[model samples]
Target: KEGRKLEQTARLIQKTAEAKNMPATKRAALNMQKLGRRMAQGRMDKKQAMVRMAQLTKQMQAQQRQLAQQAGQAALGGGKSLSQAGQQLAAALQSQAAGGQNAQGASKMQGAHSAGSKSTGEKSGANGGNKPAGQNAGHGFNVPGRNKPGDKPPQNALHGAAQPTPEMKQIAQALQQNNAQTLSEQLRQLARKAETGQMTPQQQQQAAQDLQKLADALQGTGMPETQQHAQAAAQAMAHGDKQTAAAEMRKAADAAEREAQQQQDAQGMQDAQNSLQDSQGEMAGAQDPGDIPDGPSGQGQGQKPGGKGQGQTGPPEYGGEGNGGRGGGRGKPNTTYHKGQKPSHKIRQKPGYGADAPHWLDPHFDPAKNPRYAKLYFGKPRTAGPSQAGPTRKTRPGEDTGPVRSTVPYYNSVVSARKTAENAMDREDIPPAYKKNVADYFNSLQPQSPPPPASSGAGGTKP
Candidate 1:
């Protein structure tokens, strides 16, 4: 009966020791405590109790070894499994503590626990050290374990000392081609890679240079807002501010798109204007001069047939009879006069000369009839009339105060040129200093009001 009872107690202790919820070491400790109680109660002999305690201790040690093996496997996998491995190691140590029976056993358990802890620490360090600098810093905490004693610290990719990469060269070429959209996209990608610690130091530096080049190209495009954004993005990249750089790159792309649209619109307008001008010129050239109406002077109208002097076909001679007369008549009639015969009508002197003219003004000395007179008075005199009281100022032909004709098309052309220049000056991409000069040039071209016609004084005298 005692043997059967002892067997039942040993089986119960084993079952309790292996409970999943309770740690193996705790179970072993409980088992030892229970065995001591059984011995004190005289329910078991010391030899049998010792034997059962030894078996429990071996079982706990075996469970601990299994946990250590699992930890080693987790560590080798290089994942969150590593943390799991650490938890398992802790569990194994506790299990060892529970199974310890004597001082020697306690010492062995401590040594095993230390070994398990050391292995977990080394696995964690290895995992941290292998990660990229960007990834390591991304979590907001700098783990000192990332830097092993024999490992060199990772360098920043965007440091000034890094050299350009082949990708950077390609990006620069794209910039030179004025491919703002493409360059902006490329820059964004590079910045993202940089943020994720995927770029090498050289590649990061190259990306920064490429961004600067793109900014310069945008500046050339003459879009101020876009250029400003591009420059900001470049500066951000240089400072390793990938987030800012990415945002600025997007802005630059938008600005570039707007500028391109504006250019297209301007080009379309220019083409339409050119086409209209060309069509108008063609229409004007197609018209015949013979189709025009005769002037109010009856000049260029066909002569009347069968009229008194209609058949005269010879070219008219200069200074001929009635050739240069001001009266609106075709030709003067020829008349034969006898000597001493009274003229039918009194002969009037030429319009400009006076009857009391000097002796040099012979009766036949008509300015229209004489080449010398015509040469002497090459142009009409400004002082020809008596009421012309101003000094005889020599004037060029066509200087008379005739009605001025307005050249609307010519004015429009000038205005268009000035407007184009002004628009260029208003562009953000243009240098501020150069913009002032551009504005000045266009302003100078604009027609200014004639200086308020110099205000007249009260007495009508010039101020």
Candidate 2:
């Protein structure tokens, strides 16, 4: 069993070594494609495209250089697959980068020519030549091999600006298939249609196909209920029942989330299991080897593998807490027990057993009176941190404390409270008298000005 385990470990190590460059290489290729898509869609302008293309090309070159080291390592591990894939992807990226630069330059030149043409036409019109370009250019204006405003550009137009390389497309396709993001997006679109109460026959048919694919992808993940819901949704879509389809798709989405969480937990459990198995194998191998036969040299067959010393004759020292051996002292044996009962050890006492805790542990205990605890048990007070410090109020021993001024402005605090009380008062279950009192209290709390005095006598001469 140990030999078999060692063989498996060796194979896993080799596999890991061969795939060391896979993730970064794949990422570089996919980023190149995403940048191309952005440029083609006009989301990225010319200067930005040039800078990004240059950076991506540089990254690909660096990744290629790293591939050399990876290749050497993989060769020592007996494989060159990673190096080969990296080389191919790097070459593709370089070629694609060159093509993108050329296309961008061409587009820039075309834009310059168009600007020149417009300027020349404007000058000619000013000088009494033919009407300037774009005159009467609106609805119903057509020019051969050209698209008007608000018209969808031809597919060739996108290709002319920036085209994705074959390697990038393959990487993107593989990513999309592996991830559930596309599945979730499709379900969202179907849900939108259902919400709008508008699902055409063609759309319904397409949704059915998407749901079927989702069902197939979810197979054997211990989520048969999700699969069933997905299939039922697909069937309902085919029958043109948007409501039923939407409900089923919702169930499928919830199940998929749960399944994802379960998969994550299962992966963690698998890692722990592998660790436990490794430890168990190590312990088993370290066991007594005295019974095995000796070789012709008359040497004892009790030594550990890898030319180590003789097998451990005593208990192995596992550096864990509690019980037995030199690394950990043997715990006290079980002694206290009722009559006619088997003695057993207890790591903890019953619930009420520790009610009379030590004096130092009491919640109300003051460390200030105990010099030992005051210096050792208590930590020094921390200085004020980022929060603002407020003024500390001091008063004589018999002075009465007045209402403290609020930190917040009265208007800022009272408005929300009054609004809440008003809303609560609107409830019919409360007595009208209580509501009147609450309203009067809030009204009186409002800020008021002192009444004018002695104005009437000064304004009038003698009445």
Q: Model 2 residue 329 lDDT?
A: 19
| Candidate that scores best on TM-score | 1
Off by over 4 Å in 2: 1-177, 217-222, 287-463
**TM-score between model 2 and native:** 0.26
Pairs clashing in candidate 1?
Answer: 25-98, 224-428, 224-429
Q: What TM-scores do the predictions have? A: 0.29, 0.26
Give one digit per residue, the lDDT tens place, for model 1 in 174-267: 5445454564566556656767778654455456655665455444233556668868877887887777877887776676555433333333
Provide the global lDDT of candidate 2 against the true structure: 0.42
Cα-based lDDT for every prediction: 0.42, 0.42
Model 2 clash pairs are: none
Our tally of clashes for model 1 stands at: 3
> Across residues 276-378, which tens digit of lDDT does each residue of candidate 2 receive?
3453446345543312221111011111122211111110111111111111211211222324434221222111111111232333333334443331222
